[model samples]
Target: MAELFQIAGAGDPRLRDYTDLRDVSLRKLLETERGLYIAEGEKVVRRAVEAGHRPRSLLLAPRWMESLADVLEATDAPCYVLDEKTIEQVTGFHVHRGALAAMERPEPLSPETVLASARRVLVAEDLVDHTNIGAVMRNVAALGFDAVLLSPRCADPLYRRSVKVAMGAVFSLPYARIEDWYAAPDLLREHGFTSYAMSLAADSVPLDAIEIAPGERVAVIVGSEGPGLTEHWQQAADHRVTIPMAAGIDSLNVAASTAIACWHFRPR
Candidate 1:
């Protein structure tokens, strides 16, 4: 069972991991340097732990302790008990879910490793919004896609906001960064997967019109929020695909478009 330490103030040094939760830049630096990520809410925390992530510690409001008792009993990490007000002071927001845990970040999986057995994959290029990244992961996982591959410049899926928005979907899905972003499509092709770049190009075909052969490996690519897929990716991809939309609606949000594509290309 974990040791319980009552924390009276937000300034307690031991609560450093829980401090300034809303500051993206500081949190990124601290978490990256410390090899940690924060999992918010009871369910996300439990999912993170169950997914084999080691908890550095847990910060919980008194009322949440009983709900997460099983988690506490299973780990040796200390628990810092705090009141809602102090919790708010430390985390910079109202944690209505009443639970947060700092977890040891695992080593990233290699693109090759993630692709070795994946048949249906989603590729994200330069998606800077943590929310979109998280939503994409959730959509991919919920739709039964095999994995997600991100470009080198994509947002960190393990960021606190991404983890929270994903509702722990990041834990269940297999994903990795493609360091050589330019050659991503080539890599997919080398792995025997046909790449479909989601774009608004004149030559793009309606997503429903594309046919997938039985037992075929496939990859669907979505780009950054502002600019869609790059010219290089569009040219390199096996096909340029687009969702048919109403007049004047050029595109949907990246997350929404990805969900639609994932559903269409899901294994038959």
Candidate 2:
């Protein structure tokens, strides 16, 4: 049987969570009775469904409603079918992704637990751009890295744009944020993993030269693109590794660098 939704016009109080002028802070929703982060696009929403994230509700253009039958059937949440203009007005940004979902953030993973069974992990420090963060996670997942550790300054992996850009790999990958960035390397050491900082310093060993022993656990730390790894992280790392590139190129984007580093350190 097809369910029905009586159109709740834009500005209806019940739809407050969906209306926005500025970027709706997912954290802001946590303050109110209904706390949810927005998940955009068809694929991401599908991934969320497959990941067992129940949607509180959905907002989408009328054209998208019929196309997303499988997704709707997977959940009992209300689907607010609207026209494109209505979606644009309510979301503040143009609703290019066609469908959006309101989903609660899942319980975060513990750093120790995320790394418990890992042989290789990727550690990101203060990589703020959502696209870069997503790309990094996608690369990490595709290239055989086992887990991800993030600094406090790293953007939320669950952010809608991040999720979309990552093609939902963020949901599949194991990740946890290190509470104190300064103590992160020590934590890796305590976990019996060797920390290698990815930086471009002349003293740094080339990525290809850093050999890994069989059964040895390793963590690759990538800092923000411009500053590379901080001095404290460098001091804490067992070694500093750099990608060998042409002389004219100053550096690779953090995402590109991450892909290369992760592949080299991937478990054989």
Candidate 3:
């Protein structure tokens, strides 16, 4: 059973975990230091719990309590009930979904661990946008990729914006950061995976033209939104691939291109 408390004001110390959410730098520091991440919306909260993340506390509007009753019953975490206005003041956002939970951030999986059982993977290099990271994760998962690997500089997939944008898909996908960004290609190759760099380099071939043998492990690499893949990655990857575009259109958004590539290279 959960303990319910009525929060009458926004300045309550107990609400510290939910404060200044819109301040990305502050929230990143606070969340990382506290080993917690905020899950917004009723569905996201439920998904977080379902994915084995323990809740440190829950902030909910009075009207949402009934709908999340079952979730509350399953945990003894403190539940702070407040009106939407105060909730907004505390969070620095409207929080229209009416439900938010501070969940314990799980231990990150090692790159080797993430690749151990994955036959199809998506590799993101220096993708700093949280929304793009979330969208890429969702695309990888939906298109049947087994896992994801992020370069050290990639944005945190568990960031609030990322989580909300992913609609909780982050919880279901297995991903890890590569400490040695330069050796990423070697790492995948060692695991019996052939890496295909998604690039617009002159020598790159259309993605649809690439052929995969049955049971061939594959990794589709995408880079940051602006520069695309780094020159090193473009050269180090086993193959440079491109999604052929119409005249004047050179490339697609990182997430959109990833979806197309993942679908094309998905396991047969």
Candidate 4:
């Protein structure tokens, strides 16, 4: 059972894990160095724990204590109770959800290990926006895609804001970061996946037109929101593809585009 401690001030050293949450650079550096990630809100916290992530500790307001009672009871980590004012002071923002948890980051899966069991995969390249990454992860989990492959520069799906926005889909979805961007295209091909790079190039085929051969696997590659896919991936993909749009709109956000492509190429 988690031991409960009352916090009197924001300066308490024990609350270090939950500090400066609004400072992206600080949080990123701290989390990466310590191998810890924060889960915010009640649902995300529950989902993280249920997915087998061990919590280092939980921070909560008094009102939230009863709501997360089961979660706290399952671990021996300390639960630091603080008034809303003190929490705001330490985290640099009001935790409206009233609950937060610092969880030990789990080991990362390798591309080969993830792909071995996955048939339909979504690859995110240079997508640095955490919310977009999280939203795409939810789509990947809900749309029946088998796994996610991320480029070296993609945002961390385990980031606090990302995890909350994903509603914990990050926990259930198997994902890996590709270190060698140059080899990624060939690697997917060797796995027998028909890779389609979502792009705006004139020669790009409509997403619906991609042929799915018998026993053929599929991979959808989505690029960053602003610049879209880099020239390297656009040229390397088996086919450059685009979602046919109507009216004046020529493009959609990566998150929206991903859903349409996932549904179009869903394993049939």
Candidate 5:
């Protein structure tokens, strides 16, 4: 059974976890310090619960009760039932999804654990844009990719925008951060993975040109939006792959590039 409360004002202290959602810096600091992440919409809320994340509390309009009754029943967390207007005022945005939950952030898995069963992995280095990060995750999950590895400076995949843009893909995909940036190339080689750095270098191979034997392990590395892979990381790859462009267009955005790479490099 879940405890239900009524919230009439956005200023209510009980809604602290849902406040200032539009303030990125504030939300990042608050969510990190408090070990909580916001799960919005009924589907995302359910996915978060399904992924074994604990709920500290839930904020939703009355309409979502029936749809999420099972999830609420499973948690003893307080459920703050508010109207749509109150939700908007509290969250600093329109709560079009009609539901949101404050979920406890799960402990991050190590690089080794995430890679144990992964054959075709996407490695992100310093991809700080939350939308791009989520889009990549969505594509990776939809494609046949096995897992994802993030560099130390990557953005939070659990961030609200990331979660929303991913449409719950983040809950299903396995991922971890790599602490040792310089040693990653050797580590991938040791694990029998051919690390291909996605780049535009003149000597880079076309996306479909890479040769992979049956069941050979592979890892594709993508870099940040503003800057592509650093010189050191670029040189660290077993090979470099480039998605050729037409009409004098030099390159695509990070998210698009990742999607094409994921599609082209999908397990064969």
Candidate 6:
């Protein structure tokens, strides 16, 4: 077992990193020498561990020491126990969950590599919200999508809030970014995938109208919330699909739409 440390006051410099709370980009976190991200709550940490993310350390309120003993014993990472008041002060808010972990970021898989053998993939274009990114990954995992592809502007799937909201699914799902968005569909096509762009344009076909061939490679392209598919992408796709919606509801949330699309196109 590694050494255990105790935090009794917010004045300790050791808690500096945990302070300065603001949204931090995944790129910024990755660039850090420590190569770490904060994952909060026992459930998220446990799921992250189960998904194979390496933990650097665990921080907990003094009350959780015995309850989380098994996890502490299982790794060489140091465990730090802090008083409730200090934890709140250092973290900038009260955390009733009582546990958190810092984990190392793994090497990213390339989009081409992630798509090489996939039968189905979800392509995200500039979906910058961490919550939506997390929700999309959860959908992909639930509905059997093989991988996720992100355009250059998409949110980082490994962001702390995303990891927590995804219930740690971010650690389990295979994903990668494509630097050139326009060229990716062509590459996917060359690799035997038929691209389907999701949108609400008049020319778009209802998902029910298409016959998805079994064993054929397919990729679904989804744009951000406000702008649907880019005109160039829509023109380039083999087909355009739209979900049927009730009157007065402009459209589903991008995450909801992603889930429906994944379920519709899941492998038979």
Q: Which model is ahead, 1 or 6, in terms of TM-score?
A: 1
Between candidates 1 and 4, name the one with more favorable TM-score. 1
| Model 6: residues with Cα > 4 Å off, grouped in runs | 23-34
Write the residue-wise lDDT of candidate 3 on 98-190 in tens digits.
Answer: 899999999999999999999999999999999999999999899899999999999999999999888899998999999999889899999
Error of 4 at 86 (Å): 1.2
Q: Between candidates 1 and 6, which one is better according to lDDT?
A: 1
Clashing pairs in 1: none
Q: Residue by residue across 1-268, what tens digits does model 1's lDDT show?
A: 9999999899999999989999999999999999999999999999999999999999999999999999999999999999988999999998888899999999999999999999899999999999999999999999999999999889999998899889899998999998988888889999999999999887799999999999999999998999888889989999999898899876899999999999999987
TM-scores for all candidates: the values are 0.98, 0.92, 0.99, 0.97, 0.97, 0.92
Better of 1 and 3 by lDDT: 3
> Which residue runs of candidate 5 sit more than 4 Å off their true CA positions?
none
What are the per-model C-alpha RMSD values against the true structure?
A: 0.8, 2.3, 0.7, 1.2, 1.1, 2.1
Quick one: best lDDT, which candidate? 3
| Residue 165 error, candidate 3, Å | 0.8
Worst 10 residues of 3 by lDDT: 242-251
Give the alpha carbon lDDT tens digit for every residue of 82-125 in model 6: 87777777766667787878777788898878988799999998
Ranking by lDDT: 3, 1, 4, 5, 2, 6
lDDT of 4 by residue, 41-75 (tens): 99999999999999999999999999899999899
Show how many residue pairs clash in every candidate, following the order shown.
0, 0, 0, 0, 0, 0
